[model samples]
Target: MELRVGTLNLASGRDGGGRSVDAAGLRAALADVDADVLAVQEVDVGQPRSHGVDQPAEVAAALGASDWRFAAAVTGTPDPFRSWTPVDPPVLRASWETLTGPHYGIALVSRLPVRRWSVLPLGAGRAKLPLQAPDPRTGETRWWWFPDEPRLAIAAELEHATVVSTHLSFAPHTALRQLTRLRRWCARLPGPVVLAGDLNLVGPVPARVFGAPRLVSEPSYPAPGPRVQFDHLLGRVAASRPEVRRLTIGDHRLVTVSVHPG
Candidate 1:
């Protein structure tokens, strides 16, 4: 059976303006594509900035997925320096307590029944990245030093394939290191594997590092007029090369891929 997979950076479910996340609009947009497995980044859980929305749950419900998992990369607000608290889970578990503040992370939602799941921590003892922050006085974005936030790869074993979802660091070196570790880890898993996420790198960087062919190529950032193809889907499964399409859902463009297993 052909499986439809997708990946998107939700930007905390906010539109381009970062004003608010319209759950209805998101649901409607997702319902239009109806992918079997969806991987999303920048999802929020009980976050004030996004109005304490359980973004994964909302999206899963919207898509009518049977199973969904969220691995928290940061435990507090979005600001990495001010209030962000990194969470390091020993194992990938489904349950998460309602945190006092906001929780930011990646999520995977699957319509296919999940056989098992695992979470790999890739943010240990890494140096912080300089983020562009808005200047309070001039309303301009400036580079500011912030702690290297935690990153995780959530692997879900479905009936036919093992799908891994991850969001890597913006820093090139850190992302490359994490990609290496991820390749090593996925090697131990059984069956064919499909790796999907926002790698934060351009061109064939991930394909070369992971030794997997990119299933599709499409620009998925800065929704209005995307110029970079940051989001990707790469895998070892023998299938037709997927064609990625962009769906405008609020502020960000949701990228979807369709794979037909041979």
Candidate 2:
């Protein structure tokens, strides 16, 4: 069986003018990918930034998926302007109180059949870190220090194999530890799993750090002129080369791969 999986970081659906693009624009951008399973990071839910669009729901609609989950990592926004609180006992959509602020985290959507779902929590990095962002006025890259929020990976049991989506910490050592933990977690799950996400690890470091084959290799960051590949799709299963494509919504490109399992 073959499964098409995609991973992308949604920058709150910003357009060329650095303005919000509603659900229609988001659907339009996803028209070509046609992934059976898609994992997205840096996602916003009930947030003013993306016009309060439930991004995961819209993305699931675009993919014609019936199973989807937005793994909420924080209760508030993580930008320099606002403070965020870690989500305790992270599972939601089961039974939980209304989130205090706009939620930001990673998500997973699947057009394929699902048996069960699971979430693995990776604690937040110890300190704030400088992240590069493009200046709104000049379009020049600028460094801004922002607090690190808690991280987690959402895994789904698909028909053919288990699938996982995650976003690791920007802190190098922390990310490395998370990767190791993630690898071990996947090892215990059902056989022939596909792990997809923005690992924040460069080049072959992620593969070497663990021992999974990275399905995609080309640089996917800074979409226009790529330099380093911070995005990855790793598994021991056979897979075709991914189509690393760019969207107007995010700084990083999306990677979609086709996995084959016997």
Candidate 3:
């Protein structure tokens, strides 16, 4: 059987143009992906800024995916130097206590049946760097001091394989640590496993660190004109070349790969 999977960074519920994410656009974008499983990053859950909408749930619903999990990295609006508390397990797959407060993190949604679910916390790093992004004053690209946030990875054990997704720290040194830790976790899973997301490590570095072949090698950030392969899908499985898609809503372009199971 062939399984299609993709990674999408919601960019915190908005487009590169800063418009709030909506179901219609989500549906259209997901239609293009037609993925059976999608790993989402920068998701907002029950947040006032996003009108309290459950972003991961909304995306899942849009894709008609019945299986989904959102691992909260922090509660309330995110701050540079640690201003939010981390929620524990049972806090997700998210709907349980989402109404209790707001949350920001990553998610995994699957149209396929999921036999198990898991989460991992990659502690926040103490490095801040100026990264390339749109300049608020000029509406052009410029390097701005970006702060790293607490990162989280979510995984789903489907009948055939286990897949993981996460958004790593922008700080290179810290990202390396998280990747190493995640690799150890993957080693214990089933025969074949795949990992996907905005790893923050560019090019062959992620594949090298992950000890897996990268399925996609397209630049996915700065959606306007991508120039780096920050988004990726890497693993030891048969997969078609990844398709980098431009979604109507999101700062990062969606990257999809078709997996052919043996």
Candidate 4:
């Protein structure tokens, strides 16, 4: 069997202006790539910044995918500055009517049907990191300690293999711990497995921790001028050795890996 897997961070389905995505443009970009499965991170759901759009559904619809699943890392109303600075309004608090609907997280979309799915939440604990934020009294970008948010890994079981998608912590030590936990989790799944996502760690760190081989080694961050390879595709099955290529998709570099199984 042959499978093409792709991974990218959607950055909340926008081109960085908090403006709603151009559906036509997204559809065109996805159509240009040939992938059986796609793993996405930083997807938004019913959030006001994204114009209350369901990004996973939109991307799946754009690609004409048969199955897709979204796992929310943060379910409450988003604290805009707590995570990162937003392009538009910095805050959209959970109010009387909209308290429980808005969310942000990751997703997996597949052309092939999914037999089963699972989610694994990973993080050491909430910590804080210095992020540039607008001052409450005066609108000035100042370094503020933002809480390091927890993350989740979503997996889908297809006819041929299992695909796991995750976004790890930006902190190196924290990310290493999450990667270790992910490896242990993947060990129990059946058949060939491919782990794909933006790990936030560079070089051979992921391969070393996951005990898997990387499919490609191409820079895939800060799209305009990629300096590091954060997005990756790693395989655990001995029978599968995939070939990967990078594609420029909007603000992100989409990684596509072609797997030929024995």
Tens-digit lDDT track of model 4 for 194-260:
9999998897879989998888777877677777888888886543334434333434578777776
Off by over 4 Å in 2: 78-82, 92-101, 132-143
The order by descending TM-score is 2, 3, 1, 4
Q: Write the per-residue lDDT of candidate 3 for residues 1-262, one digit (tens) a residue.
A: 7889899888765665675546565555566468899999988777654556778878888888977888888776543313556665435654333455777789999999989888877787888777654432223455666567778888888988888989999888999999999998888887488898989999999899989999888899867788888898998889985699888778888899998767
Q: Which stretches of candidate 1 lie over 4 Å from their true place?
A: 78-80, 90-101, 124-146, 240-243, 248-252
How far does residue 39 in candidate 4 sit from its true spot (Å)?
Answer: 0.4
lDDT of 2: 0.80
Residues 150-198, model 1: lDDT tens digits? 7899998988788899988878888899999999999988668888898
What is the clash count for each candidate, in the order shown? 2, 0, 0, 0
In terms of lDDT, which candidate is stronger, 1 or 2?
2
What lDDT would each prediction earn against the true structure? 0.75, 0.80, 0.78, 0.71
By summed lDDT, which 10 consecutive residues of candidate 3 come out lowest? 133-142
Runs off by more than 4 Å, candidate 3: 23-25, 78-82, 88-90, 94-97, 129-146
Each candidate's TM vs. the true structure?
Answer: 0.86, 0.90, 0.88, 0.81
Cα RMSD, model 1: 3.5
- For candidate 1, give the lDDT of residue 61: 84
